[model samples]
Target: MKLAQRTALVTGAGSGIGRAIALCFAREGAAVAVNDIRRDRAEAVAQEIRALGRETLTLPADVSDSVEVRAIFEQLTAQWQRLDILVNNAGIVELEPSRQQRLIQAHMERLAGSGAPAPLAISQSITDMEWRRTLAVHLDGTFYCTREALKLMEAQRYGKIINMASVAGLTGLAGAAAYSAAKAGIIGLTKAIAREAIHCGVYVNAIAPGFIDTPMLAEMDAEMKRLIALQAPIGRFGTPEEVAAVALHLASDDSSYTVGQVLSPNGGFYM
Candidate 1:
């Protein structure tokens, strides 16, 4: 009940890390608003929160769309009157499956010293659409939601904003140029907002988790996944629940003195 009486909104709450964070907050006594671009998924998570005996709201909107984002805040404000926590966790890996598979295969071959001498050309392979969509969802979505959440939190002089970044943002992934760029942008955004939001008693921070056992990585073939897991000293992928624990800390008073920091749960992958 560390979060008793607090209200939280978790974007992308339908699945993976976002879903874990929403449920974690609910278990700790926060009334949670679940947001997912997929309305059905949003409703599903909201139902779970209701079962937890905590208040719940379902927000179905594309965070990349400013208009949709604004409407989401309006509905939240109308229903809850105030918000204490916001998790900017909506994101996507927009690379085509075929392209992603090829890239992964190429990387493996390269590691074995058997691939083509040329680079993967991943940056050159990115279409304008892929680059824009990646940034729109990861970077722009964070900005729009943060702006709206600030409106309510600023008035109350207290809030917690947890932005989801990635290990790719810190040590760029070889073939995920767009995702790496977008996450790096989010890290920059978190830092900038933290400096400003702290003035109003709002704590802003980021969680850059390592490869987690989520649907995102479920797309990878078993061999690729195995190799990635071994990249971490822990010799395994992280769990969404594990990442949610960090989110819980940031959203509660436990992190009162923590601000503008990127707390990574990468199992020594980067450090």
Candidate 2:
């Protein structure tokens, strides 16, 4: 009951790491608000939270939309009137088939001892819409949600904000320039806001997880998945529950002294 009587809002709680975190908080005695672009998915997670005997609020909204985000906070205030935790976990990844095919071919060439460098023109291949959408979802969505959460948190003089980053942000990943940039921006935003919000008793931190076995990875072919798992020193992809454990720590009083820090759950992937 580390979070007894507390309240939390987790974006992207429909599935994967976000859903795990929502359930973890609920188990710890927090009334959870589940948010996802898909209403059915949000409701599904909300149903799980209710089964745990915790109050649940299902919020279906695209975080990238400022209007929608504001409406979400308004609903939160009307329902609970307080927000103790905010997890900005909603994100999306876009990789064109042509780009991925090119990357795969280059990888195969290198494996065949071609000696020639792989021309990963990921940046050049990114469509304007893809670039903007990636940032809009990860970076802009985080900001929109955080801005609304801060109003509630700062007023209460107590809050925990956790931003989900990635190892790709720390050690840039090939073929994912937009995603890397978005995550890197989140890290920067987390630090800057952590410094500003700490004075108001609102602690902000980030979690940069490595390859986690989430739906996000479902797009990768089996071979690509195997290769990625081996990339981690742990020799396997991390689980959603593993990342949720870290989120729980940051959400609770255990991380009282930790602020403006990027707590990476990367299993020896990027040092």
Candidate 3:
């Protein structure tokens, strides 16, 4: 087991990419801390880790909330004593009900097969409230978790951080300006931290995925998805398991010489 005896924390572990990463880490012999917005979902992932005979702790918290993020670290310290790997995977693309009800309603109507596609004009039509909410979760949340994890990693003089970005960050995806901006920031942040912390044996890296077959993409129109898949030079969408393999590589000693790099498993969709 590459990660035997190490400790890992995977945010948004209730499902999708996060769940896959959490399970992959556990199988590689890492004690995993699973965080999700839903308590039930967190517990479910935690149970899967336990089934592998690996230690696990599950707590539901909003990664965008500094208070909650700090509490998660405190609890992790109490349980695992140290964090060897941190996967900043918690993120959301949906707008809050209170802030963008009309936009969401129109979008949902389209998804329900009622009308023309309601594509939000990312650069001009987005509201201030919607922009803030998306950035709060994707960008601010990553900063909060990383800031807290940094202190712990610095003290130990060893660490591995895997920040999740997307192809949107490299080549902005239409209709997702906020998400694109946030992910781009993550790549910049990863490089900045690596330069500062590398001498101390703390490595920071990022992963940029494209057209992954995950639940989040389920909302896309069938034709849209098919067209996107065709754009992949590989002729197919990637799987969570495939991404998890890359995460496992970065989290282990195998990646000791690699730092501040954004690894993309986009099937040649982006290079």
Candidate 4:
């Protein structure tokens, strides 16, 4: 009941880490706003929260869409007039092949004779579009939601913002150029905001998770899993509940003095 009587908004709460955090908040007596792009998934989480006798609101919207983000915030404001916590956890990843540069060069040559848009490929490094889109969802979404939440928090002089980053933010991960950059941006942004919000009684922080047993991990092949497990000193993937534990601490008064810090839940991966 650490979050009793609090109001929290958790983006991407339909599944994985986001869903786990939303449920944890609800179980601890917080009224939660569960948001996700998928209406069915969001509703399902909300229903589960309600079943636990906790207050819940299911808001379906794409975090990248400013219009939808505004509408969702407005609805929350109308209902509670204030927010105690905001968690930005929605993200996407694109794995470009290592030989992308050579492939792009070949494609460009083949398209030279055709009067069509160049058959561009994401460079061996990564494509601008991929980077932009990744940043839009992870960094931009965090910015938009935090911006809106701050308005309410500033007035009350109280709030907590827990951004979801990744170990990729701290260290480069092969083939995850866009995701790595976007998450790194989140960590930097969290620190800046935390410094600014200190005087106003608001704390901003981020959690950098390592390999977790989420839906995303489920999608990985056995070899990928083996490689990831080997990377973690613990030799196994972490769980959503483990990450949720740190999130709960940051969202509550227990972490009042902790600001502008990126707490890593990784199992000795970056240490």
Clash statistics: count for each candidate: 0, 0, 0, 0
- List ranges where model 4 is wrong by over 4 Å: 95-125
Cα misplacement distance, residue 198 of candidate 2 (Å) = 0.5
* Candidate 3 per-residue lDDT over residues 9-118, each given as its tens digit: 99998988999999999999999999988899999999999999999999789999999999999999988788999999988774333324445556568669896765
- lDDT for residue 125 in candidate 2, whole number 0-100: 72
Q: Write the per-residue lDDT of candidate 2 for residues 1-271, one digit (tens) a residue.
A: 8999999999999999999999999999999999999999999999999999999999999999999999999999999999999999998887466777777778788888887776777788788999999999999999999999999999999999999999988898888999999999999999999999999999999999999989987777676667677778888889999999999999999999999899888788878
How many clashing pairs in candidate 3? 0
Candidate 2 vs. true structure, TM-score: 0.97
- Positional deviation of 214 in candidate 4, in angstroms? 0.8
Q: Which prediction has the highest TM-score against the true structure?
A: 2
- For residues 186-211, what per-residue lDDT tens digits would candidate 1 score against the true structure? 99999999999999999999999999
Q: Model 4: per-residue lDDT, tens digit, 1-271?
A: 8999999999999999999999999998999999998999999999999998998888898898888999999999998888999999987766343334434445456658545544444435566777789989999999999898999898899999999999999996755767888899999999999999878999999999998888865546555567668878898889999999999999989997898999999988888
Error of 2 at 152 (Å): 0.9
Candidate 2 lDDT = 0.93
Superposed on all Cα atoms, model 4 deviates from the true structure by an RMSD in Å of 7.0
**Candidate 1 Cα lDDT to native:** 0.93
Pairs that collide in candidate 3 are none
